[model samples]
Target: MKVLIADDHGIIRLGVSQIIKEIDPGSTIHEAEDFDETIRLLNAHIIDLLILDINIPGGNNFQMISTVKSKQPDIKVLVFSAFSEELYATRYFKAGADGYLQKDTSPVEVKSAVNTILSGKHYMSQNIREYFLQGMIRKEVNMNNPLAELSDRETEVARMLVMGISQTAIAEKLNLHTSTVGTHKYRIFEKLAVSNIAELIEKYRIYDYS
Candidate 1:
């Protein structure tokens, strides 16, 4: 089995790789520190599994998931992150992840989750599964008009932009070269049909508040 691990933290990447290698010595592991590198590896390699971090240099997994599904629909993604389950599990499942797990989970549970996914089943915390059922049954999901057809990278910039985040701050936050941020900003403005940040903020206030 071949696995690709993508995370910004070298230590986490190393640890995850070690664990996987221990579980399946035949596994060949690859590392990716950012979104672009991850995409490049997936394109160039026939990976059997992907262990992904929620946040990375190019964009968050919300954006990455879509790209992955479009380009390699059969590739399985096991999202491992530090985020609370409530904040992300529902969204990750809706975005097509095969498994959702927190970084703080025990090594045994991590192994179990991976094994569960590899067996062609979904895995999430019990609490997260209950939450999803409750929310779906009660129709608690936000029904806001979906954002326009913004590219994945552009969508990441949009989310940060609407949160009143500064362009320079966002650039640094995502580890992008400053000029690249500006390019994404311009494209976001065009996609959202908004003139500037103020209009964009106003439009996204509902999502932000929710």
Candidate 2:
């Protein structure tokens, strides 16, 4: 098996590469520090599985996954993000990622998710699945998801804010301006009835922020 990992964080790349190598000792695992390098590498070689970060430089994880699938539908793509899957998984699946796992996920789960996705099966982590199910259950009974009222882009921005990332980082990750990110955050706060960052995240926590 050939594995390609794309994450700007050097430590993440080294650690995950170690895990992948340990899991499949004979496999060749390559690394790319950004989306551009990732695609550049992929265009030259067919990778069996891609472990991608959501906040890569050239593309947000969602767009990168779509680009990969649209160009090479056979490759398996799994998102490795610090952002919670509940807020992002549906968008990722819609964007054609094969699987989603949180950054804090254990190495065993990472290996299994990659293996399952490569085998042409869905790899929904138990925690992520629970998040999906909770979302479904909320929708089934007409419960209110305050965040649901926001646009997709706004929701993405809001969730990232609650995740405690800096605005500059969010701007960099989303390919938007610092001002634009601020506007989206303002709109998210308006929609969620939050007056400040503390309240915004606190309200998010009240909703069982899994």
Candidate 3:
């Protein structure tokens, strides 16, 4: 297997590389510390799988998945990020990632996720699976869940809000103007029917952003 591990953190790359070796000692592995390097390697190599990080330089959004797939549609992409699975897993999958794995996942789970994706199956955490199952059940009863109504950008902003990030910080992090962040915040409140941050957080906790 030809595998590429793309993460800015060297230790993480080292650790995951070790796990990949344990899974298949003869597997060829490559490391990329940023999006540019990742793309360069992808163009030059016939990678079977890509372990991607969402926050990598020059590729910090859902578009990265499509960009990678556009170059190598056959490459299985496993999104490995520090982002919460509940808020980001579905979005990544929709963006063409073959699997979603949290950065803090145990080595066993990581191995399982890689094996599943390499086998041509999608992978999600148990929590994410439960969330989807519950969403399906809820959809049958009421198709009006606020989280389900959110757009991709809206959901990203909502997750930052729930994480206690100020709108100003979110704007900076997301490369948007402060006013645009405010507009997203207003829309989120309207969609979720919450007037304030406290209500927003409470609702997020209660629903798990399903």
Candidate 4:
């Protein structure tokens, strides 16, 4: 099996790579620390499965799913993120991820999730399944997550802004005008219902930007 693990954390890459080896000793594994590198590796290799961190640099939005599918429509993607399942799993599933695995899940679950996807099936934990169902039965489930309102670019800008990057720097980094960054910042705050950076940080505590 050919597998690519894309995460900015070296430790996460190392640990997941070890898990992949344990799952299949002969598997070819590739690692990338950012979305651009992830895309490059995807283009350069026939990756059977991708273990992706949604918050990796340049991957702060659900649009990443389509981007990956555009490159390799047949490649399976398992989203490995620290975000709450109730809030993000179904959203990613709708975005075309083959599976959703929380970062804090046990190695056994990780192995199971990976193995299931490799077997040409979707994988979602019981908890995620229940959350998905609840969302279906009661539409308010998804509506309650305030962060869901941000668009792709707004999400990227919000994360950078919360990380203490000034609007000008964010513009330079993302190649947008400073005023555009400010607009995104304004919209992010408005959508997330936070008036300041501290509230924004608290709102995104699940992201653990520490």
The prediction achieving the highest lDDT against the true structure is 3
lDDT by residue for model 2 over 107-190, one digit each (tens)? 889889878998898788886577666777247322456765666688667767877878999899888999999999888888
What is the C-alpha lDDT profile of model 4 across 49-163, one tens digit per residue? 9999998987677778899999999999999998777666767888999999889989999999999998999999988677567665136553665666776578668777778
User: lDDT score, residue 53, model 2?
Assistant: 90
Candidate 1, residue 42: the lDDT equals: 89
Give me candidate 3's TM-score against the actual structure: 0.74
| Cα lDDT for residue 148, candidate 4 | 61
> Candidate 2 has what TM-score?
0.75
Give candidate 3's error at residue 6 in angstroms.
0.9
Give stretches of model 3 more than 4 Å off.
136-149, 156-210
- The count of residue-pair clashes in candidate 2 stands at 0
Candidate 1, lDDT over the whole model: 0.78
Count residue pairs with overlapping backbones in model 3: 0
List the candidate 2 regions with Cα displacement exceeding 4 Å: 131-145, 159-187, 195-210
Q: Considering TM-score, where higher is better, how would the candidates rank from best to worst?
A: 4, 2, 3, 1
**Ten residues in a row with the worst lDDT in model 2?**
136-145
Q: Please give, for residues 1-210, the per-residue lDDT of candidate 1 as tens digits.
A: 889999999999888988897789989999999988999998899877889987777757375787876777888889998755654566678788999888888888888888888888999977677867777412443333334245556766887887677889888876788899999999877766788998888766644333
